[model samples]
Structures are given as C-alpha cells and as structure tokens.
Target chain A: MKKNKSDLIRYLFFLSAILSIALIILISFFLFKEGTVIFKEVGFLNFILGKDWSPTNTPSSFGILPMILGSLYITLIAILIGGPVGIITAVFLVYYTKDKHYRFLKSIINLMAGIPSIIYGFFGMVVLVPAVRYLFPSNGNSILTAGILLSIMILPTVINLSEVAIRAVPRFYYEGALALGSSKERSIFKVVLPAAKSGVISSLILGIGRAVGETMAVVMVAGNQPRMPKGIFKGARTLTTNIVMEMSYASGVHRNALIGTAVVLFMIILIINLVFTIFKERNVNG
Target chain B: MSKIKIKDFNLFYDNFQGLKNINMNIEENKITAFIGPSGCGKSSLLKSINRMNDLVDSCVTNGNIYFDDKDIMKTDVTQLRKEIGMVFQNPNPFPMSIYNNIAYGPRTHGIKSKEELDKIVESSLRKAALYDEVKDSIHKSALKLSGGQQQRLCIARALAIEPEVLLLDEPTSALDPISTLKIEELLQSLKDDYTIVIVTHNMQQALRISDNTGFFLNGELIEFNETDKLFTFPENEKTENYITGRFG
Candidate 1:
C-alpha cells in the first residue's frame, strides 16, 4: 500500500514537471501557426527588412526594421546604464556590506523586484518624464528616457542574479588571493569576480531579456514614433511597444503584423536564452 | 634565526577555545611541521602565523605573534600576508590561466611590465618545481591541471611575491602517494629560501620533510623538537603513543 501511494505521488510530480515543458511547446506551436500568416501575405524578407511601418495608409507597408533597431538600441543603452551599477552593487552586498546593513539592503532589492511593471511605467510617466524634460531641451519622451526607465526596471533582475552568482563562487578563490597578499578589493575583483564570470554573464543576458521584453514602461516613456531612431535624444518605437500600442484596434493584416512582431521579439529572447545556456554549459564543462 | 615567535598566544572562536596559551619560536629557512588528530588546533596554529584566522567572524586571539621583530597583529595585514604566504590543503589556484595565477601576486604589488611578470612567473613556477610540466601550457586554465599540478601552481603563486615564510596546511593530504612525495620533495627544496611551516595528519610526512616537529593535542602543543629526535625518541608519552601508531 505504501509503495503504491508513493508511486502515485511520484507520477503526479512527474506530470507537474512535464506540464511546463508541454505548455511551452504548445505556446510556441500556436505562436508560429498564427505568426506565419503575415509572412504569406508579405514576403518574409520584406516583412523583416523593410523600413517603412505604416499599417493604416492607403497601401499599408509592414516593415519592422525600425522597431527592431529601436528595441536593440534601447536594450543596449539600458544594459550600459544598469550593468555596471548592478554588478558593483552586487559586489558591495556580497563582500563589503556588514551583516546588519546587508539584510536591510537585500530587503530593499527584493522589494524592487516585487514592484509591478505598471507601477514602474507610472513612475516614469510622472517623475522621469518631467525630470528629463527639465534636464534636456527635447520633449523628454525619447529613447534615452525609455532606456533609463528600462534600466531602472531591470535593476532587480541584474543585481539579484549577479549577487547570487558572486556569492556562489567558492570561498577558496578569495582566500587564495588574500593569502597571496592581495587586498580585499583586489581579491574580489581579480579572483572571485573571474570565478563567477559565467554567472555574471548569465545575469547580464537575463537583464537584456528583461529589457527587451518590457512593454508598458517603454510605451509610457518612449514617444512611440515608428521611425528610425535619429539619436539618443529622439523618440523611438520598440517591437514590444509597437504591438501593445495598436493591438487594441488593429485589424486584418495590421493585427497579423503585430503578431509577427511578437514572433520577432520571441526570437530575440530565444537567442538570448540560447546564449545563456551555452555559457552555463561551458561553465559546467570547462 | 627565529622567523616567528608566538608568546602566550591563545585563540577562541566565539566562546570556544581553539588554541590554548602557546609559546614557540620557528627558525628561518627551516621546515616546521605541526601534526595532530583532527580539530586539535594544528591548523589553527598554522593559520595564526599569517593571520588567516582573521577571516573567521568569531575568531579572537590574545597575546602576540611576531614576524621578525614586528607584531603581526599590528602590521598592515596585506603587507604581513605578502611577507608570509600560505598554501591550503586543497589546491586553490585561481580560476585563471596558470601564467596569470603566478603573476597575480606581482600584479597586486604593482608589477605591470609584461617582461618582468613573465620572468617572475617562470622563476616562481621553477621554484615550485612546476615550470617544466606547465611551461608549454602556461596560458591554459589552472583548473585544467591535475590535483598535484594545481597544488604546485598554488605554491608557485605564493612564491611569486618572494615571501620570507610559507605556511602550508596539509598541502598533500588530498593528493595520491606519488603526488604527496613530489610535494614533500618540493618542500624540501623550498626550505633553503623560505621558512616553511606545515600542518599534517601524516606523522611520516612530518618526519620526512620537517626540521622541527610540533605535536599538538587538544589545542595544546604536547611536544616540539628536532624531527629526528622527536620521531625516534619522543619526550612526551602522548607524542610517543601518536608516533607509535597508538591512539591519537
């Protein structure tokens, strides 16, 4: 009787484990099924590479090159702003911070992760927009604003993961460096940091994923201009923002184009995760 | 010449006494080995020389540990460590290339020129008896090396800074017999230039490579004498029992 009950529990646990994988396969299958319809209507190359993205014109053209570029630029800028700050904060938390302060700081970081995306968007709209407008001459709703907002949004992910990675490094490396007469800071930066290199890289990749997939905050801060991003100061439209901005009222080919844009975003995230997996595998093997 | 002097030294982790009041003098350019059963303060005493015990949050020390004439507790810790290097029981080469691992100490001390660093790396590796084995694969990750090679690389890393004293904590306990013998031989060669202090569970290891052997029991130094005399004719009953393969 005990063996049978245990076997049943084991089977249930296996089913629960497989359910997530099955859901992912099903979701991807449906996404591809729906997303490919637009490619049939417009050539795949044209859909992906064309620059003009007018969905409501007399003869609507669906080119998402601008949106793709906007997403790339915004994500790159966000990583630039957030990556170093997050990593430094992580180092401070792991190595330098005293035990009493560590708990307080850790709670605040956890709170940052728990805050909602919509709240972050609202914060950008109310505070960041006015601040940027005052600092710079432009209308403030630009790629720079979006990048800054996204940078803030991605901080929790970057800092938390980097901290964990840094902590996961074996204590021996730090001891080894210290025993060789290296200062605490030197030991951490040179030896401990290198030992946790793959984990840090993985954290950055995850941060990039968070930045790319973010939609609500980017929409509120970015002016949603569907043109090539002129510069850091100019407004832009990301693939995510493009889909969310028109998904409510878009029809026919317009709707399919948005879904197609979703496919592109999905592909970008997939590639990022693939890179993360490769890095993780290399860390394990080498 | 005495390389280090411990005067009424006592160590505690929180309220638990780790090392009892101890007094000893270690000579320069000689290998001193501390042997005892597990958790008997052999390693604790070894770590005390270079102040590695400072890493433990609750660890407290009383009295003096003098390196040369300067008290180690008062001297700048980084400077003290540079003067007194250490090798752990487990080989802990940095997760970097073997060449970089050797250069880390010099780099920390502000040697930036590539030629100087290269010379230091070669000479340090040679001193650890690891240069010929790792010369061609200098750029390879130290983690890729065998257990013994990695331990030797760690020794090379410690030697790179030209420390006056080297503290080793059971450095060969994790190695096979051949690797253990190789390390013992390396330590033998190393003692001419460095004051070597080692902690080992192996009585044979202590007898073979050490000039002076200190037998510890329950956080106390039971015996300290020349290795030849101590192993062959122990003054203390506990030391004799331990060396005779009786209860530790």
Candidate 2:
C-alpha cells in the first residue's frame, strides 16, 4: 500500500512538470500568433522605422519610433544614476560594513524588495513628481522627473541583486586578496567586482527592463505625450505606457498597434535575458 | 632582537578567549615555526602580527604587537598590510588568468604599465617555481591549475607585493607530500629576504623548515628556541612530551 502511494506521488510530480512546460509553450505560441500579423500587414521595417505615433488622430499614424526612443531614454537615465550607487552600496554591505549593522540593513533592503511595484510608483508620484514641479515648474511633468522616479523604483532590484552577487563571492577570494597585501577597496574593485561582473551586469539589465516596461507610475509622472523626449526635462511615452493608456478603449487597427508594441517589448526583454544567459554560461565554462 | 614582538597580547572571539596573555619575539629574516595541538592558539598568535584577526568582527585583542620598531596596531592598516603578507591553510587563487593572479598585488600598489606588471608576474612565478610549467598558458584561468600549482600561485601573489614579513598558517596542510616538499624548499630560499612565520601542527615540518620554533599549549607559550635545540633538548617537559608523540 505504501509503495503504491509513493508511486502515485512520483507520477503527480512528473505531471506537474509537464503541465508547467505546456503553459509556457502556450504563452509563446499566443505571442507569436499576435506578432505575426505585423510581418504580414505593415512589414517589420515600416513598423520599426516609421516615426509617427498618433494613433487616435483622423488618419491614425502608428509608427513606434518615438515610444521606443522614450523607452531607451528613460532606461539609460535610470541605469546611469542607479548603477554605481547600487554597486557601491552592495559592496559596503558585503565587504566593509560592520557585522552588527549588517543584519538590520539587510532586512530593510529585503523589505524594499518585497514591497509592491504600484506602491513604489505611488510614492514616486505623490512625493517626487510634485517636488520637481514645485522646484522647477518650467520642467514640470518631464522625462527627467520620470527618470528620477523610475531610478527609485528600480533601486531595490539593483541593490538586492548586487548585494547577493557580492555576498555570493567566495569568502576565500577576499581573504586571498587581503593576504596579498591589497587594500580592501582594491580587492573589491579588482577581484570581487570582476568575479561578480555577470551578476552586476544582470542587475543593470534588470533595472533597464523594469524602467522600459514601467507603465502606471511613469504614466502618472512622465507627462505622457507619446512624443520624442527633447532633453531630461521633457515629456515622453514608452512602449508599455502607450499600450496601457490605449488598450482599454481600442478597436481594430489601434488594438493591433498596441499589441504590436507589446510584441516589441517582449522581444527586447527576450534579448536581454538571452544575453545574460550566454554570458553566465561562458563564465561558468571558463 | 625584536624583529616581531608581542607583549601580553590576549585575543578573544565572542567572549571565548582564543589566546591568553601571549608574549614572544621573532627574529629578523628567519623562519619561525609555531606548532601545537588543535586549538592551542598558535595560528591566533601568528595572525596578530598583521592584524588579520581584525577581519573577524568579534575578535577583540588587548596588548601590543610591534614589528620593526613600530607598533603595528597604530600604523596605517593599508600600509602595514602592504608590508606584511599572509598565506592560508587552503590555497585560494583569484578567478583570473594565472598571470593576472600574480600581477594583482603589484598592480594595486601603483604598478600600472603592462610591461612592468608582466615582468613582476614572471619573476614572482619563477620565485615560486611555477613559471616554467605555466609559461605557455599564463593567460589561462587559474582554476584550471593543479592544487599544488594553485598554492604556489597564491604564494607568488603574496610575493608580488614585496612584503617584508610572510605569515603562513599551515600552508602545506592541504597539500600532498611532494607538494609539501616543494613548498618547504621554496620557503628555504625565501627566508633569505623575508621574515617567515609559520603555524603548523606537523612536528616534522617545524623540524625540517624552521630556524627557530615555538611550542604552544592551551594558549600558553610553553617553549621558544632554535629548532635543533628545541627538538634535541627542550627546556620544558611539556615541549619534549609534545614533540616526542606524548600528550598533545
């Protein structure tokens, strides 16, 4: 009787694994089916190259160049501002900070990670957007404001990933460097940082992805105009914001265009993940 | 006489005393081996010289440690560490090309030019006797090397900084007989330039490589003398007993 029960449990486990694979395959098929329409109707080149993005206008232009530019702009700013600070904070937590404070700070960072994305956006909206508008009214509802807000939204991800990466470095690596008479900072930058390069890079890529896809929070603060950003203090819209703003009340061509935007975002995320996987594999094999 | 001096140095880890009121002097440019049973605090005493114990958060120390006429505790730690290098019981090479592993220390101390780094790496590896075997593949990852070569690479890394003192905490404990012999031979050659202090559990190693030796028992320095004299005629009965396979 016991043997039969054990066999049943084993078969159930196998069934769950098969079901998980089936679900992923189904999702991929759906994405391909929706995205294939673009190749047939608009052609990939026109969809990618055409810059006009006024879908609700009389003629209904649907080029995504502006939104793509906005996405790139916001992602770039977030990475530029967040990358160094995140890495340094992680290094401090792992290598330099006193042990008594480690646990307390680590838990606070963990809490930041656990908080919902919407909450971060709300905080950014209520606090940062208004503050920027008050201080620099001429730059109100600008790309700079959105970028700064998104940097905060993604700070937890960068800091958490970087901390884990730095901590994951084998204790012996630090000891070995110290034993060689290298200063702590030198060891961190030269040895620990290089060894954790893949992890740090992945963290940066993750932050970029989050910034690119961020919708509701960015919408509330980024002055969503679906136009190319002129500078740090200009309004903009990303592929994600374009979809969220129009998807609820769209029909026919407009819906397809928004779905097309989603497909592009999906591809961007896919490429980032693929690059990370390749680098990590190379690091392991070497 | 005071090449490395410790006066009433007591070390503790989280309220547990690791070494109690330890006092000793290590001569200059000589090989001093510390031997004892497990947990006798030999390694603790060796680590105190360079303040490596500071890496441990709960490690608290009382009393003085002086090296070369300066109290090491009060010196700039980074400068002090640059002058005093260390090796461990287990070999740990940086996860990089073998050449980079040797070049890391000198490069950190402002040796920027590639040609200069390359020369230092080569000389350090040759000194550790690992250059010839790896000359063709210096750019290859160090993790691919054998255990003995990795240990030697670590030694070469320490040597690249040109430290005055080299502290080894059972450096050969993780190696086989042949590798251990190679390291002992390397130590003999190295003692000409650097003051070497080794902590080992092996009585044979102390007798073989060290000029002077100290024996510890329960955090206490039982005896300190020249290796030959200590082995042939120990001043303390405990030292004689510990050396001759008596109670540890």
Off by over 4 Å in 1: A1-15, A98-101
Per-residue lDDT over A1-286 for candidate 2, one digit per residue giving the tens place of the 0 to 100 score: 9999999999999999899899978977887788657656777767766788777899877788888888888888788888888888889888777777988888888887777767877887788777887887544677777788788778878888888777878888987887666778888898989998888888887878777778887887777787666776778888888889998998887788888888888889888778877766664664
Task: For each candidate in turn, give its C-alpha RMSD to the true structure in angstroms.
Answer: 2.1, 2.1
Tens digits of per-residue lDDT, candidate 2, B1-248, equal 55889899899999899888888899889999999999999998888888888888889999898988799889987778789888888989999999888888887788999989988999999989998999999999999998888889888888989999999989999999999999999999999899999999899999999999999998888899999999999999999898999887
Alpha carbon deviation, residue B188, candidate 1 (Å) = 1.6
State what share of the real interface contacts each candidate retains.
0.86, 0.67
- Candidate 2: chain B TM-score against the reference chain B: 0.97
Please give, as one word, the docking class of candidate 1.
high
lDDT per residue for candidate 1 within A1-286, as digits (tens), equals 9999999999999999999999999999989889989989998889989899999997999999999999999999999999999999999999888899999999999999889888999999999888989999889898989999999888898899889889988899999999988999999999888888888898899999999999988999999999988998889999999999999999999999999999989999999999989887776764
CA lDDT, candidate 2, residue B183:
95
The reply for model 2, stretches above 4 Å from the true place, is A98-100, A134-137
Error of 1 at A222 (Å): 1.3
Question: lDDT of model 1 at residue A37?
Answer: 91
